[model samples]
Target: MREQQENAAVLRVRGLNVDYQTKKGAAKALKDIDFAIHAGERVGLVGESGCGKSTLLKTIMGVLPKNGDVTSGRIELDGVNLLEVDDETRRKARWAEVAMITQSALNALNPVRRVGDQIIEAVRAHRPIDKQEANALVHRLFEMVGVAPERARDYPHQFSGGMRQRAVIAMALALSPKMIVADEPTTALDVIVQDQIFARLRELQAENQFALILVTHDLALVAENCQRVMVMYAGTLVESGPTEEVIAAPKHPYTIGLINAVSVLGSDKQPISIPGSPPDLMEKIDGCRFAQRCPLATSICKDQMPEAVVIASPGGERMVRCHHWQQAEDFALRASNPDVWQSVSAV
Candidate 1:
């Protein structure tokens, strides 16, 4: 039986499409991607750097550069179309409703300005608040994200990479937004510090009851922290489901390939890698985006796209797009050694 519909979605993205036009040619940066985020849900968008992960976020935040345009789609946050709102309305609706801690938020800060001033500025921009009240709120934010409240007076250059990131997060929270989209929040940091950031972000999300959309290339961490996972390739969503089920056993060939590359997921006893690169967005593709690299590719896969198939499990439901997901799963189950499987699947 199908699960009962939960009419509790906070954000719904339907048939979303984005494109870029240059003198050379037109590029489909985002295909007909569809997904929904419920209240307080933690969803991870996992994919390679060029897989249109970041581009999709930019479109949602209403900050797409002049080069990119929404060809067609609906980004409804709290029942309003974000794309339909004008600049003036988007400005007011932005931070107070939906804020983003974009990648490299440390660099997003002005080097000379006091970090406290930045938070205060953000708060005052959206509401009628004085600097004194803003500073108090800023101090609370700093403490919440693990930065020293006293250091709020310091400039961006004075803090370490992690500290600056915490400050950036503090700034993003000045409005107490309903949802936050964090793009590669821990990128370029050392592994130890990366762990700290991930832990801290998880804690913050828990306390706020805010929906979190985590976009990153880290497959292992996504499986650990996120409630659900969405895998994308060549501008389209390839797989999506609860983290545990997808990590334990993947259905889509691309999802399997992602798991195979991650040592923690049991795809490899040691470090294994998925071979070949993804197709370029600047060029047109007639069939599956991963057909060029998929080991299970057939004439049907090469010449046409596969519709999504639902895989049910104890943890959660998974939606995969592949003509031969079941076939690939059967082969891998029989072909891989038991001992090798043990190393990859510690859970």
Candidate 2:
């Protein structure tokens, strides 16, 4: 039954390429990105900073900055190509079909207006509901997110950080969107609040059955909340598969490095950092972007870009982009040694 639903994806992105125009040149922010999310499925996107995670989300929401352009790709939501739609059509689709929960709730809410009014306006903008109906919906949403309904009339300054975030969640749920893109939604909250918010979000998702795309750097959070994970490196999707399988046996060197860099509880192994920063996107490169930093990279990896190779897994098909994917077991063994990573110098 799950496989059948996976076959009919709720959202799909194919061959996406995005670039930002700068004085130096066009910086390739997203390169040939492809993925799909089924109805009610949860997928986590993990990557280091400046690896195009936010860029991908902004592109999907049609909210990219003025300089950022989607050079080529198709962002299909329920078989409708979002890139082909007009500005008004895209605006209508937002919150109604897809919504975003940004990292900064303070930036998302209006400082001067009441929180409840902001949410009501969001609902009435896309929906033809009256003020009374919208107000009722806001009250219900506040209750769902653990925010007090009576406090809806309070300004953003009056609410605590956690309360503000909950209010943002309430706004995102106003229209019960089909898909929600949460980009580090709990970045500013305490650990306890983060856990609570996630618990509430899980409950809401189970009830609403909306597809969720969680963009975060927290691999532990991903392992706990998401069923699948996608790893990005230097504007490219290097690996993606079932969360458990990918976490246990990563096929990409970059993915391996990321797992090793995190400190695990009850584990004595010291975290090994991946040496070297990511490649500069402004410059054109012929080979894999991770070659300079990857200990397993060879001459071929440095000379030619590898396409994504699909491998069968117990959970499903896993995709990895590496010329030496056949030697992943060997690479994993060698990657555990800190000397191997330290020996590589960025070219």
Candidate 3:
């Protein structure tokens, strides 16, 4: 059963292009994004801020803002294209098939309602269950997430930050969805709380075997929690592979910068920052979006976009979107030197 679950894909995204209409023009939030997450797998999506991590999650959840549009894409969940589904069908699927745990727990919960009642409402929305059944389910979920079942009636404000996040996790798991999208679920908490929350989440994931998509800027968190990692930049997927391989030896310049920027404990090495900011999405971009900040970029990189290349790896297939990926080993050595990144000037 575990092997079969690993072979089945829970979510598959193909040729996804999302744009947000602005006064200036349409800002490309996601460009030709494609990936898949298998059942019982955990994949981490890491990138700098404004790299369309949230945009991609929102698109998957069918909660994009009014101005944001998926111009082209097929979001296949369990062999069904969610884009073609009606609003009612999608709404029914949101928490039942695929649920999202947002970054802010306070905003996700209703301020006026009791926490248990909110979770009860979520459970009853999709399943035909009476109040007693829903209440029982909520209590079980709360216990699963390490929150006391008796305190389910507390308001959101009554729970501490970590507890609120735990409640959100319980709500997400209330319907026993096949997939869970957690967008920096513990970003606001301190180290100790963060560790405790992740420990509980790992335990629950082990018991339930739901596919998890964790979105965060912290590579260390991804390294510890995820089996695979996808690196995004300027609304594009730059690199993806097994977590250990990708972190130990990155292929894309942006990914290398991200890995190098993480501060290591007890290490004398200073974190190297990427020199320039991301390109403006509103402006028309030619060639590679990262060319201006990439030290290894050449004339071709400045004139044309690089296609995604697949490389065989011991753990799994690795994908990189860089024209100079063939020379990544040499580049990786130079990238460790701060001078290489600092020499590049933003155009």
lDDT by residue for model 1 (1-347), tens: 24233456778898998999888887998988888888788899998779998898888888888989899999988778888888888888777888888779666799989999888888888888876787789879999999989999899989999888888888877788888888998886887888898898889888887888899889877876799999999999989999887777777767776776666545347544656677888888767888877766777886777877777777666788887887866745643343433333211
* Residue lDDT tens for model 2, 4-94: 7556798999999999999998999999899899889899999999999999999999999999999999999998999999999999998
Query: What do the candidate models score in CA lDDT, each in turn?
Result: 0.81, 0.92, 0.91
Q: How close is candidate 1 to the true structure, as a TM-score?
A: 0.91
Pairs clashing in candidate 3? Answer: none
Worst lDDT window (10 residues) for model 3? Answer: 1-10
Tell me the RMSD of model 2 versus the true structure. Answer: 1.5
Model 1 misplaced stretches (Cα beyond 4 Å) = 1-6, 264-268, 334-347
Residue 154, model 3: lDDT of 91
Instruction: Compute each candidate's TM-score over C-alphas.
Output: 0.91, 0.97, 0.97
| Per-candidate count of clashing residue pairs (backbone under 3 Å) | 1, 0, 0
Model 1: lowest-lDDT 10 consecutive positions = 338-347
